[model samples]
Target: MPAKVGAVKVNNVGNSSVFNIGDVYSMSPESTAKTYAGGGSFITGDGIRIRLGQSTTYVTDKDKLDQNIT
Candidate 1:
């Protein structure tokens, strides 16, 4: 038996992927997490408070974007 798909709609796809009806031979996935924050509370005067935001860099391999699968 084979997979039967109807009215398939792909909205968005990101990073390296193997989207199809088949089996994958090999795949290497890597992922990591790092956070940085200022030691302070969410209490401030009636004004815009300056705070440091957390961010992460996406992994890339030469040209293609590596899929950081967990």
Candidate 2:
């Protein structure tokens, strides 16, 4: 059996490249990994943003996937 823990946030922007998940997350516009379409905005309560036209690829690759073994 596997127990679910924590939460994940997915960004559906077009070209943005910012993804954040967990209890507490924060990012500044100047230090953002990629540039957003219109502008970067924070997600309510989650303290994350993916910009206007960015998309999330959090776990699309197997080599970079984060697996939990308990």
Q: What tens-digit string does per-residue lDDT give for candidate 1 at 1-70?
A: 5566667778776664546644556767555554444444444778766555864554444754445455
lDDT of each: 0.55, 0.46
Name model 1 segments beyond 4 Å from true: 15-30, 40-70
Model 2 regions lying over 4 Å from their true place: 1-13, 30-70
Best by TM-score: 1
Worst 10 residues of 1 by lDDT: 34-43
Candidate 1 clash pair list? none
Worst lDDT run of 10 residues, candidate 2, spans 29-38
Candidate 2 residues 1-70, lDDT tens each? Answer: 4445676555484453554443444664332233333334434566565545665444345564344333
Query: Positional deviation of 12 in candidate 1, in angstroms?
Result: 0.9
At residue 61, candidate 2 shows an lDDT of 52
